[model samples]
Target: MPDSKYAAYQPAAPYFDLVRRALGDRVDGAHFFDLVTDETVYEVLYDVPGWPRVITGRDALMAAFRGYVGAIALESADRLVVHVADGGAVIVIEYEVRGTILASGVRYANRFCSIITIGNRKIVHWRDYMDSLAAWAALTAPRGV
Candidate 1:
C-alpha cells in the first residue's frame, strides 16, 4: 500500500503500474515528469532496434518510453518474483506485462527481468532485459492472422 502523502501518484491501471512496484519508496517525490535526477542511468541490455542502450535523466527516459507507450496499451503487469539484495539497495525483479498493440490490435505479452538500484530512496540505476524476439513477433504478425 502506498503512503497517504504519495497516494495520488499511485500506479493506476493502463499506465505505469509496473514502474510503481519498481519504484517502491522512491515514488514519494517521483512522477513520470520528474522521474530521474542528474545521476540517474537507465539501461536496456538487449539490442532493441530503435532504442538506445543507455538513457540518462527524466527527459531522456521519457523520450525512450514515448514510442513504447504510444504503441501498446498495457492491460496488466504482474511481478513473478523479486529478490532484494545489498541490504535492500539492489532489487532484481522478474515480471510479465500483457498488452495490446494500438495499431494492430494484436495481443502482446512479454516477460522481463529488471535490476534496480535505489539510493536515498530514489532510483539511481535501472537495467532491464526482455524477450526481444517475442516483442518482434507480436509487432510483426499480421493483424487478425
Candidate 2:
C-alpha cells in the first residue's frame, strides 16, 4: 500500500466528476461527488475493531479509502437514489459499489447510504452506512479459483 497521503492536486474518480457536473449546475450550498481532503470532516456510522468511526481531515480519510481501493478494483460506482434535503445542507445518497478483490479474486459488491454536507464546493461532513457483514464475507473468503 502507498504510504503517501492525499494531495489536493490529485485527481478524483470519474464517478465523482460525473456527479459534480450533473449537480453543480443545480445546487448552491451542496458539493456533490467531491474528494474529502485534509480540510474535510467525515464520520462513518459503522464501527469495526480497527477501522475509524470518526474521520477528521482529508489525509486520514483518504488513507482509509486508499487502503480499500487498493484492495478492491472498482468496476462501477452507482448512486441509485439521491435526496437533497434540509435546504441543501444535508444530502442523502444511496449507492452501490461493485468490484473485485485483487488478492482474493473474489467479487465484491456493497450497498451504501451516505448523508453528506457540502459547503463552498467542498465536502465538510459525511456519514456512511453499509453492509459490513457482507463486506467481511467477501474479504475473508478463500483466495483461489
Candidate 3:
C-alpha cells in the first residue's frame, strides 16, 4: 500500500500527496493505499457510471478507480485544501481533477470535497462529493468537439 500500484491510474496522487505533506506526522502512510485500512469504506454522495454510492474495502475502491480511468483519463489533480480536526481523526479535503473523456474526447474538470475519518492511524471511512453536472457535460459532449 506504499503507492498507487492498485489503481490503473494515479490521477488523485497529487491531491493525496498534498494531504500527506499537510498532515505530516499526524497521518500514517506514504501514499493513498498505505493510509487506508483494508476494510475502508468509501462513499460517494452522487451517482456516477463507474463509481458507486458505497464501496467497502481498499481493493474495491481501487477497482472503482480503474473503472473511472476507463471513462476519464485524468491529466492533473490539484488545488487541494485540507483541514484536520478531532485530534487528527477527521480530515476534510477540497480538490479538483482535470482530464479528458475517453469516449467523447471532451475536456473534463470537476471539483470535489471529501471527508475522511481515521482510526488506528488508518483511514477507515471516506465521504465524497463532486460536481456531477460538470462530469455529465464532459461525458456527454460530442467527440473532439
Q: For this target, which candidate reaches the highest lDDT against the unseen true structure?
A: 3
lDDT by residue (13-87, candidate 1, tens digit) is 333556665656644453534445677899999886678999888667766667666677778888668788998
Which stretch of 10 consecutive residues in model 1 shows the poorest summed lDDT?
Answer: 6-15
Question: Against the true structure, what is every candidate's RMSD?
Answer: 4.3, 5.1, 2.3
Q: After superposing candidate 1, which stretches have Cα over 4 Å from the reference?
A: 1-15, 30-35
In model 3, the Cα lDDT at residue 118 comes to 83
Instruction: Supply candidate 1's per-residue lDDT for 104.
Output: 91
Query: lDDT values of the candidates?
Result: 0.72, 0.65, 0.77
TM-score of each: 0.80, 0.74, 0.86
Considering every candidate listed, which one attains the maximal TM-score? Answer: 3
Cα lDDT for residue 114, candidate 1? 87
Off by over 4 Å in 2: 1-37, 48-50
- List, residue by residue over 12-45, the lDDT tens digit for candidate 3: 5555566566556755778766777768999999
Residues 16-77, candidate 2, lDDT per residue (tens digit)? 44345434544443223234556777778876545788878866775666665567676767
Candidate 3, residue 56: the lDDT equals: 90
lDDT of 2 at 16: 46
